[model samples]
Target: MIRVERVGPLATIQDLGRPGWFDSGVGIAGAADRSSLRLANRLVGNPEGAAGIEALLGGLELLAQRHLTVAVTGAPAPASVDGRPVGAASVLEIEEGQRLRLGLATTGLRSYVAVRGGIDVAPVLGSRSRDTLSGIGPEPLRAGDVLPVGPPPRTHPIVDVAPVAAPAGDLLTVRVVPGPRADWFADAGALYRGEWTVSSDTDRIGARLDRRSGPTLDRRGAGELPTEGMALGSIQVPPSGQPVVFLADHPITGGYPVVAVVVDADVDLVAQARPGQPMRFRPC
Candidate 1:
C-alpha cells in the first residue's frame, strides 16, 4: 500500500485508456507519454495496461506502506527514495515506511511512476484514468489520498531500461498524414510542412499551433456539418486558421475541419512539448 504524503501540481492514475467508450462520453485519459509508462510498467513486471500514476510537471511524493518494487520514467525529474537519489526508468526496492519524492522536471512536461501490481483504483468505464473534462473516474490526486496497492502474482518479470531522450531543438519534427477532411483546405501538405509555433494556449485537450496565414478552405456549398468524432492525433483548423493538435484527453467530438493528423508514433513528442516551442510537420 502507498500513502500520499504529498501530491504535487497534478497526479492521477492512468493505464492504456478505455478506447471505444467515447460514444458514451468517456475520454481516453491515459498517459501522455505512453512509451514511458509502458517502460515503467515493464521494469516493475506490471501488466502493460496496468494503471499507474501520471505526474504532470513532476513533484509527486508518496510513502510506501509495504515492501514493493517501483520504477519512474518519462520526464527528467531528479527522483529520490528515502532522501537518496535514484535514476529514472530503473527499478528500485521501495521498502515499507520509506518516503519517495520527485522534484521538478527539467525537459519534459509529464512523468510516469509504475508500482508492482499497479494502482488499485476502481475503474470507471473500464479505465482508471482521470478525465478532468468529463468528470469521469477519480479526481486529481491530492494530499492525504491513500492509494491502494494490490497484491501481485507469484511470478516476476525483468526488463532493462531503454534510455529515451528529450526532443532536441525548438522545432519539433512531427510526422503527419492527410486527414479525413484534408481536401477541405488548399495545399494541405504544404500547410502542414510549414513551421508553426506552440502557443501558451495548450493543454491535454489540444495544443494550439500559431500559424502566420489562415488556412484557406471552401465551405460555401457545404451545409452546416454535425459534430464528428475526433481522434487522438487529429489536427483541426478552426475559423481562426490556427491548427490545434488533439492530445490524449481531447474531447470526443469537434466541428472544426481537420487539416492533417499527426502519426501515432510522433504524438507523444507533441504531448511533451512546452509552450513557445516551434514545431514543423512532415509527410509520412
Candidate 2:
C-alpha cells in the first residue's frame, strides 16, 4: 500500500481505458501517454494494462506502507526516495515507511508511476481509468489517500532499466488521415500548411490549436453537422475556426465536423505537446 502525500495539480489512476462503452456514452479515458504507462508497468512486472498513477506536471509524493518495487516513466523528472536521487526509468525498491518524491518535469508534461503489483483501485466499467470529462471512475488523487497495491507477479522483473526518448521538442509534427468530413472544408490542404500553436485551453479532452495568421477555415457546408461518435484523434473544428485534437478523455459524441484524425502512432506526440509548442499537420 502507498499513501498519497501530495497529488500536485492532477493525478489519477488509469489503465488501458474502458473501451467498447462508447454506445453507453463513455469515452475511452486512459493515460494521455499510453506508451509511458505500458513501459512503466513492464518495468515493474505488472500486466501491460495494469492500473497506475498518471501524474501531470509531476510533483507527486507517496509513502510506502510495505516493501515493494516501483518504476517511473514518461516526461523525465527528478525522482528521489528518502532524499536519495533515483533514475526515472529504472526499477527501485521501497521499504516500509519510506517516501518517494517526484519533482516537476524537466521536459514533458505528464509522468507515469507504476508499482510492482499495480494500483489495486476498484474498477468501474471493467477499467480503473478516471474519465475527467464525464466524471466516471475514481476521483483524482488527493492528499492522504491510501492506495492499495495488488500482489506482485510470480515472474521476476524483466529489465532493470529501459530508457525512452524524452517527449519534448520545439516543433511537433503529427501525421493525420483524411477524416470523413474532409469535404466540408474549403481547402483541406490548408491544415497541412499552417503552423499552429498549441493553445493554453488544451486539456485531457482535447488540444486546441491557435492559427494566428492564416484565414479561418471556411466551411463549405453551412448546415450543422449531425451529432456523431467521436474517436481518440478526431480533429474537430468549432465555430471559432481553431482545431481541437481529441484525446483520451474526449467526449463520445461531437456535433462539429471532424476535419482530420491524427494517426494512432502519433497521438502520443500530441499528448506530450506543451502549451505554445509549434505543431504542423501532415497527410498520411
Candidate 3:
C-alpha cells in the first residue's frame, strides 16, 4: 500500500478512461496528458494503460509501506526520495517507510507517477479515472488515503530513463480541423487568427482560451443548438465569443456551438499548457 501524505493543487488516480459510455452520458475522464501517463507506466514496467497518479502542478507526496518501484513523468517536476534528489523520468526504488516527494512543477500543468504494479483502486464504469465534471470513479486523492498496488505483471522493467522534453515555455501551437458546426460561426477563421492565452479557469473539464489577438468569434446562426454529444478536443464557442477546448473530463454533451476541433495529437499539448501560457491554432 502507498500512503498519500500530501496532494498539492490536485491529484487523482487515472487509467486510459472508459470509452463507449457517451451514449449513457459518461465522458472518458482519464489523465489529461495521456502520453506522459503512458511513459510513466512504461518506465515502471506496467502496461501502458495501467492506472497511476495524475498530480496537478506537482506537490504530491507518498510513502512506501513496503518495497516498491515507481516512476514520475510529465511537468518535469523535481523529485526527491527521503530528501535525496531523484530523476523524474527514471525508475526509482522506495523501501519500506521511505517517502517520495515532488515539488511544484516549473513547466506544464500535470505530472504522472506510476508504480511497478498499477494502482489497484476500485474502478467505476471500468476505469479508475476521476471525472471532475461528472463525479465518477474514485474521488480526488486526499491526504491519508492508502492506495493498493496491483500484482506485478510478468515482465520486468527494461527502461531506466526516458528523456522527454519538458513542456514548452513559450507559445505552443496545435493543429485543428474544422468542427461539425463550423458554419455556425460568422468567421470560422477567428480561432486561428489569434495567439490565445489559457484562462485561469482551465481544468480537466476543458481549457478556456482568451484571445491575445484577432477578431472575436461571432455566431451567424443565432438560435440555440439542441444539446449534442461533445467530443474531447472540440473547440466549443459559447456566447462570450471565447473558444474552449474540451479536455478529459468534459461533459458528454453540450448545447454550445463547436467551431473547431483540435487534432488528437495536439490535445495532449493542450493538456500540458498552464494558465497564461500562449497558444496558437493552425488549421490542418
Candidate 4:
C-alpha cells in the first residue's frame, strides 16, 4: 500500500481507458501520454493496462506502507527516496515506510509512476481511468489518499533500464490527416503552413492552438451543424478560428468542424506539449 503524502497540481489513477463506451457518451479517458504508462508498467513487470498514477507537472510525494518495487516514466523529472536521488525509467525497490518524492518536471508535462503490483483501485465501467470531462471512475489524487497495490506478477521485469523520449526543442512538427469535415473549411492547406503556438488553456479535453500571424480558417458550412462523433486527435476548429486538438478526455461528440486529425504516431507529442510551445502540422 502507498499513501499520498502530498498531492501535486494534478494526479490521478489511470489505466488503458474504457474503450467501446462511446455509445454511452463516455469518452476514453486515459493517460495523456499512454506510451509512458506502458513503459512504466513494463519496467515493473505489470500488465500494459495496469492502473498507475499520472502526475501532471510532477511534485508528487508518497509514503510506502510495504516493501515494493516501483518505476517512474514519462516527463524527465527528479525522483528521490528519502532525499537520495533515484533514476527514472528504471525499477527501484522501496522499503516499508520509505518516502518517494517526484519533483517538478524538467521537460515534458506529465509523468507516470507504476508500482510492481499495479494500483489496485476499483474499476468503473471496465476501466480505472478518471474521466475528468464526464466525471466517471475514480477521483483525482489528494493528500492522505491510500492506494492499494495488487499482488505481483510471476514474470520478472525484463529490462534493467528503459529509455523514453521527453518532449524537447522549441518546435514540434506533428502529422495531420484531413478530417471528414475538411471540406467545411475554405483553406485546409493553411494548417500545414502555419506555425501555431499551444495555448495556456490546454487540458485533458483538448490542446488549443493559437493562430499566431496565420490566416484564420473561414467556415463554408453553417454554424448550427448537427453534432457528430468526435475522435481522439481530431483538430476541431471553433468559431474563433483557432484549432483545438482533442485529447483522451475530449467529448464523444462535437458540433465544431474538424479540419484535420493528428496522426496516431504524433498524438503523444500533443500530450507533452507545454503552453506557448510552437508546432506545425504536416499533412501526409
Candidate 5:
C-alpha cells in the first residue's frame, strides 16, 4: 500500500480508460498522456492497462507502506526517493516507509507514475479512470490518501528505462480532419489552416480557442440541436463561432456542430496545452 502525504493541485488514478461504454452513457476517462502511461506501466512490468496515478502540473509526495518497484514517466519531472535522486524515466526500488517526491515539471502538463502490480481500486464501469466532466470513477486524490497495491503477477519481467522525449514547447501543432459539419461555414476549411490560441478555459472536457479573422460561419437557421455523441477528437463550434476541441473527459454528447476532429495521434498534444499558447491546426 502507498499513502499520499501530499497531493499536488490535481491528481487522479487512471488506466487506458473505459472503452465501449459510450452506448451506456459512460465517458472514456483515463490518463491524458496515454502513450506515457502505457510506457510507464511497461517499465514496471505492470499490465499495460493497469491503473496508475496521473499528476497534473506536478508536485506529488507519496510514502510506500511496503517495498515496491515503481516507475515515473511523462512530462519529465525531477523524481526523488528517500531523499536520493532517481532517474525520471527509469524504475526504482522503493523500500517500506520510503518517501517519493516529484517536483514541478519543466515541460508538459501531466506526468504518470506507475507501480509494479498497479494500484488496486474498485473499478467503475470497467474502468478506474476518473471522469472530471461526469463525476464518474474515483474522486481526485487528496492529502493522506492511501492506495492499495494489487497482488503482483506471478511472472517477473525485465523492462527498459530509456527516457521519453519531451515536447518542444507550449505551442503545439495539431493535425485535424474535416468534421461532419464542415459545410456549415462559408470557408470552414480555412479555419484549420489558420493559427489560433488555446483559451484559459481549456480542461479535460474541451479546449476553447481564440478565433482568428477568417471565413464567417452561417449562423442563420443553424440553431443548436439536441446533444449527440461526441468523439474524442471532435472540434465543436458554438454559436459564438469559437472552436472547442474535445478531450478525453469531454461530455458524452454536445449540441454544437463539429467543424473538425483532431487526429488521434495529436490528441495527446491537446492534453498538454496551457492557456495562451499558440496552436495551429493542419489537415491530416
Candidate 6:
C-alpha cells in the first residue's frame, strides 16, 4: 500500500481504459499517453493494462507503506526518493515509509508512475480508468489517499531500465487521414498549412488547436450539420476554423464537421503535447 502525500496539477488512477462502451455514450478515458503507462508497467513486471497513477505536469508525492518495486515513465520528470534523486524508466526498490516524489515535467505534459502491483481501486464499468468528461472511475487523487496495491503478478521484473525517447520539445508533426466530413471544408488541406498552437482550453476530452495563422475553414454548404458520432483522433473543426483533435475522453457525438482524422499511433503523441506547443498536421 502507498499513501498520497501530495498531488500536483493533476493525478488520476488509470488503466488502458473502458472500451466498447461508445454506443452507450462512454468514451475510452484512460492514460493520456497509453504507451507511457504501458512502459511504466512493463518496467515493474505488471501487465500493460495495470492501473497506475498518471501525473499531469508532475508534482506527485507518494509514501510507500511496504517494500515495493516501482518505475516512473513518461515526461521524464525529475524523480526523487527521500530527498535523493532517482532516474526515470528504471526500477527502484522503495522501502517502507520511503517517500517518492516527482517534480514538474520539463518536456511532456503527463508522467506515469507504476508500482509492482497495480492500483487496487474498485473498477467502474469493468475499468479502473477515470473519465474526466464523465464522472466515472476513481476520482482524482488527493493528499491523504491510501491507495491499496494489488497482489504482484506471477512474473518478476527482468529489465532494469527502458530507454525511450523523451517527449518532443520542438514542433511536432502528426499524420492524418481524411475525415468523413472532409468534403464539407472549402479546402480540407487547410489543416496542413501553418503551425497550430495547442490551446490552453485543451483537456483530457480534446485538444483544441488554435490556428496560429490560416484561414478559418469555411464549410461548402451553409447551415448546421447534424450531430454526428465523434471518436478518438477525430479532428473536428468548429466555426472558428480551429481543429480540435479528440482525445481519450472525447464526447460520443459532436455537431461540428471533422475535416481530418489523426492516425491512431500519433494520437498518443498529441496527448503529450503541452499547451502552446507548435504542431503540424501532415496529410497521409
TM-score of every model versus the real structure: 0.91, 0.97, 0.98, 0.97, 0.93, 0.97
Residue 266 C-alpha lDDT in model 2: 89
Clashing pairs in 5: none
lDDT of each: 0.81, 0.89, 0.92, 0.90, 0.84, 0.91
Worst window of 10 by summed lDDT in candidate 3 = 213-222
lDDT of 5 by residue, 1-284 (tens): 99999877699999989988888888887888788898888888888999999998779999999998898988877899988998877988899999999998877778899998999999998999999988999989999888999998765557557656785465578988886877666677767665788888887788898855445444446566677888998988888877888888988888888888998888888887777778888876
State the weakest 10-residue window (summed lDDT) of model 6. Answer: 214-223
Ranking by TM-score: 3, 6, 4, 2, 5, 1
TM-score of 3: 0.98
Q: lDDT by residue for model 4 over 1-284, one digit each (tens)? A: 99999977899999989998888888889988899899999999999999999999899999999998999998877999999999889898999999999999977888999999889989999999999999898999999999999999998998878876667758889999986888888887778876999999998899999976567677776655699999899999988888999998999999988989998888989998988989998988
lDDT for 265 in candidate 6 is 92
Q: For residues 1-284, what per-residue lDDT tens digits would candidate 1 score against the true structure?
A: 88888766788888888887766787787887788888888888888888899888789889998897899888778899989999878888889999889998887778889998999989888889887677787888888888887778555766555566754436678888877887776567656545777898887778998864344433333544479988888998887667899998898898988877888998888988877877888877
For model 2, the stretches where C-alpha displacement exceeds 4 angstroms are 212-215
lDDT of 6 by residue, 104-180 (tens): 99999999999988999999998999999999999999999999999999999998998889999999999999878
lDDT tens readout by residue for model 3, 1-284: 99999999999999999997887888889999999999999888899999999999999999999999999999988999999999879999899999999999999999999998899998898998899888989989999999999998989888789888999999999999987898998888888887999999899999999989888889996689999988889999999887899999999899999988899998989999999999998998
- Sorted on lDDT, best first, the list reads 3, 6, 4, 2, 5, 1
- What RMSD does model 1 have? 2.4
Q: Stretches of candidate 3 above 4 Å error?
A: none
Superposition error at 99 for model 5 (Å):
1.1
Position 39, candidate 3: lDDT: 94
State in Å the error of residue 51, model 3.
Answer: 0.6
